[model samples]
Target: MQPGADDPWSAPVATGPVRATVTVPGSKSGTNRALVLAAAADGVSRLRGALRSRDTVLMAAALRELGATVTEESGPGADQGDAEIVVTGPVGAARGTATIDCGNAGTVARFTPALATLARGDVRFDGDPRMRDRPLTPLLRALRELGAHIDGDRMPFTVRGTGAVPGGAVTVDASDSSQLVSGLLLAAARFERGATVTHAGHRLPSGPYLDMTVADLRAAGVVVDVDDPTADLLRAGATPAASTRRWRVEPGGPRPLDRVIEPDLNSAAAFVAAAAVTGGEVTITGWPAATEQPGRMLPDLLVAMGCRAELVPDGLRVTGGGRITGIDVDLSDFGEAAPVLTGLAVLADSPSRLRGIAHLRLQETDRLAALAGELGRLGARVTVTDDGLAITPVPLHGARLDPHADHRLAMTYAVVGLAVPGVTVDDIATTGKTVPDFARMWATMLAG
Candidate 1:
């Protein structure tokens, strides 16, 4: 049977040790961004290794709604092999009134609206109830300054574009989510005046995402102010010799670059966490030596918790030495990994403190609270602070773990099930939002 089958709940017992090398799919972050950029670009872009998960599908559908032609090329082996997404942009075409369903995807909810601002006429966007709770005021306010008409601050909003966005200078505090910044940056090059963005809020959470956006923008041949400091003389795309907290994208337009997307490193973390907890070894193929994906930092975190992490021809091998020691990691730069870290922390021999990720509160669910509550149901003791989680190595028993319709949280509980017996995960289907084959892959990874 295919993954995410008939059973809505998955409770796979770890029979003996987990030893397998899993090949995860493309990065959801990268795939969604590529989809948006391809749609916003002036020419057609082909995305090789694009992920086909619920989240990315929402992104693709949203782009299609905005009048882009998204073709998923299929052949004899395309279903099981690497597939490609060919996006024919509707640039300057009649991207008339359309409706977008974000479907619990923050990227689609936050990123696509900016792209819609480039299209003409009305574009209305709505999503799952949870999306309504997610933050969008900053992005909306920023888009408003860029001369787009928005109906509201949150989900179920409308963007009225007059065939062009008179983009110049706008500032938004990207401290909560970097999508607001990255989304605007992705479409900035297509703006009539280009776009200049500055962060007016506290330090941007997940600074790497900002860098990733700028890197992609530059790679697409958009002019970026390498350093937009107030003292430096500005270029043609300049708003002002701005503060260090600013980013600018020149108005020349976006260039479509043919590039293969990287595997979702965060998805790979699930297999790594399995190896970490079961005192076994798991290899992830094609692990990059250098990349911008936040999952790149997992090897370092694994090494800190009594695991042997090494890069070999086989892949990035993480050998769980049958013991997990307490790890104190400040995961500020990569909050996406926090759920995986939390699962490992509970099974450690000592207490682990994960600091500097309070921004996780604004994620799909109140991540810290949801993680604490779910693990607590499994007879684990965890304390939730304002910013992070403090987990003690309390022997955990099995219980039903609700996924809260969040894919990452669902996968995190699956990791715990590798060591603990009878850890039933409800709504395992929720993992389809990112890892569509999450359960089937887990079952295969556990095959003895």
Candidate 2:
């Protein structure tokens, strides 16, 4: 079924342990980042296995507007291995006048504006209603500080490009979103003086995403230097130390790349969670052996909550123990996975405290508040904390959940519905923002 086709979807309750081998689509994060870097690269770049979700489509369209020639080798519904996106970089010839619609995609909204600054004309950016409310000022202010002429502080603003950006050092407060940092660093290579970004705020949210950005840059032959004090501390399970993080990108645009994108691990987490909540075993194929995707933390996150996660030759397999124990953990690195994790928390045998994700409030929706309210509608005890959510297990009953137009929330609500009968989710179409054909995929998994 298409997204929103079943408006108030009665979530399918798991009648038995769900067993399936699922192959999820390519990574949205990787697809958009590749698109951005490719658009600024020195030669033609080809992305195989690129996700064809709404977000990536918008990113491709945005780049095309800026004079990049983006061509899909196959149809929109092509198989993963056959789907290829060939992007002809527009580094020196970006069109000056174009109107870009971000369409509620954060990467599209935040990352595209910086690329637009390199054009020699006017580039206007706007998005869905909620995009107006999302945080873009930090990135916008940073662009203005870097010698680009900008008209406004947020969406519905225009970036007046002079064919080149006078890029230099700029300190930004990226406490609300790491995209602010990634956006600048991605386009730094084309800047006249290169670019250096220093984070001047609380611990940067989604620190690993910055690492992914750096990795993508390096893979495309761009030179980057990073100094983050909290990296080791956070990995060791200690609270972050107060210190600044800095990244320097040299003034040489990226070389073209021919990359085979990895499957979307954050999206795969939903299916894994389905296994955990239903005492089932689900294997997600094409799981990367090594990567910087923040979803790498999913296996450990599940292991801590009474599930067995192992990486066999076939893929990453998660087997539920039939009882979920509560977990108190900080999810600052993978905030995108919070919604699905929150779904697991509500079904746990005890209390779960998820901290270090205060920045979620500024996302597509106020996630912490939305989770508390939606889960509470089904009789789950969820409290909103300053930085996270505290979920106490209770006998949850079925109720129609509102996802607030957030893709992750819709997937989360679907997870909760697997264990509780009569649970319905409104706007399941929102899941299309990342995972296309989600209804059919979910049904297929249960069918097995």
Candidate 3:
């Protein structure tokens, strides 16, 4: 049985030095986008090297609900071989409708509605209760403006696809999640006259993820035009008349493809933090130097915090000795790393302030609150605001931690427990949503 959100974790046991090569999982964002594109494509689209994490699995299941044929097969390589998900074109009733369960995945919840526009029937989208509570008003308003019939119920809302979405300018507030914007862009190609999008207030957080969406659309045979004057404005070309098209997903692990996903820098962050706090040396293998993911800035940030981190051919080598320093840095690009960095901040010599993370509140959990609240339980002074968080370096004492059923929070606190004795985390199972083998991998690194 799955553990409840309120459960408290066991105290952390002593963990020794960590020295081993670790292969991170594929990007959840990339796999989810590929699954959606494959479903919208005209021919049998094959996705290679796809991630099989909970989020990706939910996307696959959602596509299956939409009447796509998805297959999984092992690849013939050192890394997990290719997962051959074959998407048969949109074969369901032109007006067919289905209720999709997005589980706890924010990516699926946001992306699924846009895909519904191609269907001829009413698509009722539902998810875990927490997901329903997360705001969808911005995306809903944008879709309605584009002529989509959206009923605004919390979880049991119904979206009726008219196959006639207007291709004109629509402004979207993407401060919550960039997935909403990506979803609209994904469906833009299918519109009769194409579409234009403008970001309303502050620039969308995780802009790189949106850029990835645009790049993926182009790779899948969709044309997009960006207005130079305004960074937020974008124009998409009409869906290609040719329904049948073929594209190859590049393989991972030391590949030189232009757009292949680099190893998950976010996942590597936990181990990196572990090494830093324990005064140990751990090298994260498979990270590319030119990657755009915000987590890729770990080495530089760690260096700024007085840790020695070098980028190697394989991955990153981090060594810890000197006292950690407080940093006041804008994290608009690497918002996902904020939680782990917050944990590090608790051990720093001075107070640390992380800014530009207002978007974090809308993630899988209210990450800002979760971080501040849960870390406070471990005897740290953390203050959370609407925009970001401030941590006054306090001598951390080990205590039970509540992960709030968030994978990143669970893993971040778990690493924190390694340094601060007696720390335990509740609902560690949630880590499987992203890193299924987190326990085993962590054990292996400790064993080395």
Candidate 4:
């Protein structure tokens, strides 16, 4: 087994009871949309209780690059203790050309280009080397077809907006990331002519998120019409010009948000799987019964594996008593939870076959290969197909687990290592990008 000491994760330790109240952060998707909307709107938008994660930080920085004055302060009121971001619209035209470094923030990488259409001069969009390599060809082609001048089809690309965008029917293959489609839809609302987007292949993976984007656009005074089973369309029937606008963002924290961020079912899956693997009980609260986030399927899937999952008033409670069983399930909607599911598969009593997950290969890392490679190192018999993973349960003799510098991989493997005998990860600090207190929270849960 290859030691994953070179990766960014910590050594795994034993875990105890998983009872704890976790106050997850605000929704990354919502925060990004609010930032983009605030930037393009005419007035000073006060976004209260925004997420202060790496991804949101990147979006805020990108907004600044687009000539918006962004200021960060604490709370709706001085006593709330929640963070507030105030964005002043572009003074006149975007003052100067700027280079936006999106880092590994896919939201910034995808959405910033659309905002670039509003810039006065050329805006160069780039990101971390890994991010630069991620495919943006679909988005570039769509934008160019819409009359935006994009230097290259890939990153390190230059975008010069003519202050006007011509919209038409654009076909986008969003099999990689839904952010591409969302970006085009957002930019289309501001187009001189309306835009209609047709999915080139199978329907989008995160349908709920795409719906959320449309809902948010409507909230910002943009009229969006989503005719299901047909191409979703946005018609800017008339140019609705606003002199200035003010938007108050919902506050942050574990307390119920006006716009409750659907429980991070993706994150909770790790703990749920951890409890399953360790033959213990784990309960995650605040998971909405009606959540659009696809990751919310964790409890149902865990229950299929013979784990007892009960949906309580606040959240889902999971208990593992019998041996873990593997069942075939389609992960098209819940693609983000694939990493954790792969880890769970290794602990199952029978061979676990996950299907409808071809999109996993395109995430932060080639997740399918990364999972297979790392899990194989932990003595699991894992095989990868074009779509999903097929794994036969084995006693996980913890070897070094590499996170491939991806946050999801890091956290998922950390949970696996904790339940196993000896597992250590390299570069654990990457968890700070999303769930900074992952280790602390895990420690607290285990302490009880």
Candidate 5:
């Protein structure tokens, strides 16, 4: 069951080294992407090691509602809440109105509405009131340019489909959300002309996330052309003719989910932060040596914060010494890692600056505002920036932190509570959006 807004959890402040080996569940990113890709694929695709959290469940449920067949089975892993889901592809809905509930997941809000364009009937979308506010204009514009008859520009909108889209060149200023680009690219292969998506604004934030989408798309047999300001920045002097801020997906179908999905590294980051807070060692088993998941950047962020990180045979091991230092870093490529850093910054011995997270304001909540307010209530001097936060280290005391219906905010509250006394985090149940059994998992990590 989902936790209510008023249920506050007493945070357990750690008094010693938090030694534990935790195996987190599957990636919400991977699971949701797989669900969308499988629904576009030609045959039955089984997603092993999938997360069944509120976010991914919402994705699966939306796909199921749109005529795709999704079945869940017991997961083959250490975590019991995990599951193996089987999805049947592109079940056609020739007629009818389908309503999709996106909850607060960015993936669902942006991705599913485009996928609905493949249907023959009208697909209406709405979610939590906050979901209604997240940016959908770019995606809607791109869809309309591709021949989709969409009504209303945001949530509570409708996608009137004629069973096919004449996909072609469309430009979008997707500076506010990377999901806007990813959602379109994921389902572009189904379009008659495929798609050529060009970003008309500044360089894309969270480049790794876009890389993940392209990698997944190409792995599933879609042909994509990589031409972005950042990609050009990476490959200099060799490809002068390459187009910047553009991605072209060849019209075709994708493959099934034929392999096991990796664990949610971002979710595992909270446990890693626990080690940092208590000056203990945390070794997450089955850590992929390399990947595009944003959480893979945690080691560098931790090291910058004065924690010791090393790659061990079992997994990545992070050890926190007594003192935690503040840092100045740009988190544009990996914004998901910001909250963990924010939690540590409050306990640091110096000032910290986290920049390039302006996109966060469009997330599950206005993250910058939420951080500024909650951390202020906890007695920290926080300056909310245009893109990030400037936090000054100060002695913190216990206080109530309102999570504003955001999972990351609530999770960060728990981390702050690990060092400060008498911290109560409201809307504790919101953590269910990603981390399964968050309280129990946190307890187990602290028990060691």
Candidate 6:
């Protein structure tokens, strides 16, 4: 059984170099995206190796509420919780009243609502108390602009679907979260006139996730034309400021998918990071040669921090030197990895500046403030920067870390604990939001 939220877990410290091979579950982002696309597809879509976690489970449930059938059965030779998800789709216009509990999952809160607009009756969306603060206004307003009738400006809102949406052009400021953009694009192909989205924000973080959304849509046979303004701006020697990174999706039925979900590289990074911290080696099995997931940059990031990373036939292997060197970097495309990277940076030889992540302030928790407070509590000099963080290495000690209900924070502190003894994490089970059995996985990696 998983630990409860109130449970305090003593994070295990490494006795020697950690040498192990770790395999992670399916991608939360990919699974949820596949669920949405499957619900919109023409026929049955089968997803093998889908992750069973709070977020993905909530996503499947939300789709079911929208008149789609999502079933799960254990796959042959699959790990615990690994299942083949069968989604019978092209949810019709007869879908009646439905209520979606987003449960603080950003993908559910953002992506599910777009699918709700295609329903024929009232669809109410609500989530955990923390979900009320996440950015939904942009997506909601974009839906409204595309002929969707929404009752409120935020969560606990009602989507008064009229059985059809006259999707057309709409401009959105999605700097706060890329999910807003992905949510719109995912449901656009079903719109009567298709859909066109233009980003007018000052900055667009997590640009790679948008690529993932577009790629998934293409895999489903949706025609998407992306107009990136950066190339033109660079040709003119002008810095791009997000004038309009537009995407146009033509109205059509997405082809049913039969694909295997890839391993979640974001969550897998912690194990590879264990190697970096303990001066050991770790191999992450089933590492894809290419992926739209932003975590694909892990090898480059590790190499920048004085670690050696190689892609082997089976997976990606990382070997850490006894010493870690700091470097300056911008994590706009992969800010979700910031917390764990910050933990690694605390042990670096020089100061580290992580920039382009101000939007983290509005995620599961105010990540910037939480990381600053929690890391500072452990005797590290962490200053919350405007767009990211600045960390200076100092002698550290173990302390009970409060993740403030954020799973990333819990994992980040746990990584720090592998080096700093006596460290404890409040609500280590919060990692279940993504990694269903994080505690066991960490222990197994260390035991090897």
Which candidate number has the best lDDT? 6
The clash number for model 3 is 9
lDDT of 2 by residue, 1-448 (tens): 6556456877899999999998888889898999999999868999988888788889988898888889987734453322589999864445546889999999999998889888767889999999999989999999999998999998899988777888999999998889999999999999999999999888889988899999999999899999876766777887864647999999987999999888899999899999999999999998999999999999999999999999988889999999998999999988988888889999999899999999999998999999999999999999999889999999989899899988899899889999999898888888887788787889999998
Prediction 2 TM-score vs. true: 0.96
lDDT value, residue 320 of candidate 1: 90
lDDT (C-alpha) at residue 409 in model 3: 92
Deviation in Å, model 4, residue 127 alpha carbon: 0.8
Q: What Cα-based lDDT does every candidate model obtain?
A: 0.81, 0.89, 0.72, 0.70, 0.86, 0.89
Residues 245-349, model 1: lDDT tens digits? 787788875777787888888889988888888888889988988888878889999999989999999679999988888888888888899998888889899
Superposed Cα deviation of residue 158, candidate 2 (Å): 0.3
TM-score, per-candidate, Cα-based: 0.93, 0.96, 0.87, 0.85, 0.96, 0.98
Off by over 4 Å in 4: 1-9, 74-82, 90-92, 230-263
Cα distance off (Å), candidate 6, residue 65 = 0.5
Query: What tens digits encode model 3's per-residue C-alpha lDDT throughout 57-96?
Result: 8888877766666676554321331244556665354324
The clash count for each model shown is 0, 0, 9, 9, 1, 0
* lDDT string, candidate 5, 296-376, tens digits: 889989998889988899999999977789999999988888887899999999999999999898888888988988899
- How high a TM-score does candidate 1 get? 0.93
Supply the TM-score for candidate 3. Answer: 0.87
What is the alpha-carbon lDDT for the whole of candidate 1?
0.81
- Write down the worst ten-residue block by lDDT for model 1: 74-83
RMSD of each: 4.3, 2.1, 7.2, 7.9, 2.4, 1.3
Off by over 4 Å in 5: 1-4, 77-80, 229-244
